[model samples]
Target: MGFGAMNLAPVYGRVEESEAADTLLAALDAGFTFVDTADIYGRGSSEDLIGRMLEKRRDEFVLATKFGGNQDSHGILIPGMGRPDYVRRALDASLSRLRADHVDLYYLHRLDPTTPIEETAGVLGELVEAGKIGGYGLSEVSPSTLRRAHAVHPVTALQTEYSPFQRAPEEELIPACAELGVTFVAYSPLGRGLLGGTVRTAADLEEGDWRRGNPRFQGGNLERNVSLADRVATLAAEQGVTTAQLVLAWVIDRGALPIPGTRKAANARANAAAGDLTLDASVFRRLEDIVPRDAAAGAQGNESYLANLDK
Candidate 1:
């Protein structure tokens, strides 16, 4: 299992510095071997926090970081990665900020719609030749784009949002990855806490929180989604596990790595424990009916967010 440190570094919450360190320590102590961070996560604070926490035992874990998104840019995100010089500079800067000589996995966070994927991937392949990154990946790309990128270089993984609610990747991306022998790293496997039954209503989120305005968390959709989540909770209770565990079990059972994020130690342990929960084919079949392809009513996010999928 991998830990996502996007919200653990106090950008959206009041997480204390010591608490962040403790969270990382708890994950490490609990046997988490992989961690996912990004240069743009918390404007670089997430990497800094993980860097400080793992300074003494850096070799004990695999570190993954992303580039391609601007740290300070607001409003709608535009596709980037135009200049080869900028890509090289970004990798060097991320290494400097991480206080490490190389990254275990380096992902281009998103494909630059304006630039050719092969060109960007070619430069990334060059970085591997230079020994700056151990493995390379792409996030949120379509099957066509992935095949094009992989043709330029051997892509190690494809990071995307894949859960019960967001199953579009299954229609094409998963099969492509299987054919190409690339790992599918599933991010947001818990549906941003919705599938875990932690969020009941839009009112529960703090002001300015991204989820508060998300379509899936608004009005009737929130109610409907919560109702669906309750069913997952019911099944989890019958299985003597938490809803989080059931969700993670389903994810890993699909043969993709589930990278769920958490700022709390208990949640980390629970998520890690999900690795041992094996769902038989019968159970998976029942779950498919329970959380069908169109189980939820609302969209995963706003139109702009989906638009960035480059479909």
Candidate 2:
């Protein structure tokens, strides 16, 4: 139910325009009508790719995109969301690149500590009035910040990193969303590919790859994490499915949609199929015992991640 463009472009590789177009078509064919992207991903390349691909079937999909953090009027880098002018200009540029009159879901990619949340919400609400966005959302926000934003407007969803390894959201954010009638969008539900047991060691990571810098996948932490994945694999074997399927099923079981990103068509199909894997109560209990909240081997992220999230 969650499809995003964060991993499709320059971060993974310089995707040829032709291949990129094919991927979008493949997604649509597979019933993934909701596509998410941020202005910062590939500095707008991902949105541009989506724009081109949707020319023929714009009515067939729900296009979701985000703005916030720093970017020029044209969506080039600046540094922070300092004022209302920044929000207006950023949305204008995103709309232009996406080649759409309005986005179905617009999100604040990060909370700008320097700017008052009220002021930010005011501008986003104005966009909804101007027919530039159909709905608004927040990412990585705390329960209090979510309340503040919701008071400003009806927040349709709250996007956060949620998984067995990252249980912080369940502590407060998930319940807050439920109370506020906001859909919970769980990003990185596969634990950055760890639950799949593909990244066996630090050597398996490519130099300069984003996963290398991730604390959960580093040093002895990687080995310890794999031990947990082995338990998942065992459960999957009993069910006659892949570990990835089991992990995804567990996330869906938790009442949140798991949005994982990958470049391979086979992987994408597998992920979508996991939405159908109904884990029995016994398997779910076994999973909770094997990878409880504290069993995760490393910090979800260091101070940098905390710095980026809403307080």
Candidate 3:
């Protein structure tokens, strides 16, 4: 299993430093071999926390982190900054924060429109040659972009949102990755907790929570989504598993390594246990009928967020 460190960031909620460190350690103890993070997450707070907690156990896991988004003075992510110089600088900064000389996998968090993909790939290739990163991946990119980037340097993986609620990648990106022999690393396999059936309403979220602004969690969209999630919960109950476990099982069956983030040790243990819950073909068919593609109420995110995703 892979651990997503996004929840360790304050953007998700108010996570105490001690709790965050313990959470990472808990996940490691649970047999998670891969951990993914990004520089923009809490303006480097996530990486810093990982550095502090896992610096001594670095060899125990494959550490992966992303770069490319420039942050403002307030630590807000200013999207799209993938120039060659910026790429080098970003890797250096991430290495410093992670307290590691080299990361197992480095990702270009978003496609920088200002710079050519070939140029970005070339710099990452150079980094690989320089022994700074073991391999490089791309996030939220398209097949054409992957081909172009891979021409310069082979992409080890493609990170994107893939769950029962978000199946857009399956139509194109999944096939492309399979054809290119690239691993599809799925982030948010639980539909940002919706598929988990834990978030009942907007009030359930903590103050200043980022999900409050997500389209899927607002207005009529949220109401409809809750109903949809209830159906998954029902199925999970029938199978004697959690809604989150069922969702993670489905994502894994689809051939992607899912990185589900959680702050609680119980939730992490539950998520890891889902790796063994195999869904029968009949149940899988029933699941498809329950939550079909495009059944979700809103777009993956707001306009600005969706704009960054390669078409």
lDDT winner, 1 or 3: 3
Question: Is 1 or 2 the stronger prediction by TM-score?
Answer: 1
Candidate 1 similarity to native, TM-score: 0.95
lDDT per residue for candidate 2 within 1-311, as digits (tens), equals 66767767766444566666666677777777678888888888888888877867889877888887444455343455735898888888998998888888888888887787887888888888888888888888889998998899888888988877787788899999989999898888878778866678887776556677678888888889988888888988999998888888888888887777766666777777887777787898888888888788888866565567776
Order the candidates by TM-score, highest first — what do you get?
3, 1, 2
Each candidate's lDDT (Cα)?
Answer: 0.82, 0.79, 0.89
CA displacement after TM-score superposition, residue 250 of candidate 2 (Å): 1.6
- Full-model lDDT, candidate 2: 0.79
Residue pairs with clashing backbones, model 2: none
Clashes found in each candidate (C-alpha, N, C closer than 3 A): 0, 0, 0
> What tens digits encode model 3's per-residue C-alpha lDDT throughout 175-262?
9999999999999998898987669899888998988879999999999999998998899899999999888888888899999999
TM-score to true structure, per model: 0.95, 0.92, 0.96
Model 3 residue 246 distance off true place after TM-score fit, in angstroms: 0.7
Error of 3 at 294 (Å): 0.3
Write the candidate numbers in order of decreasing lDDT: 3, 1, 2
Residue-level error in angstroms, candidate 2, position 184: 0.4
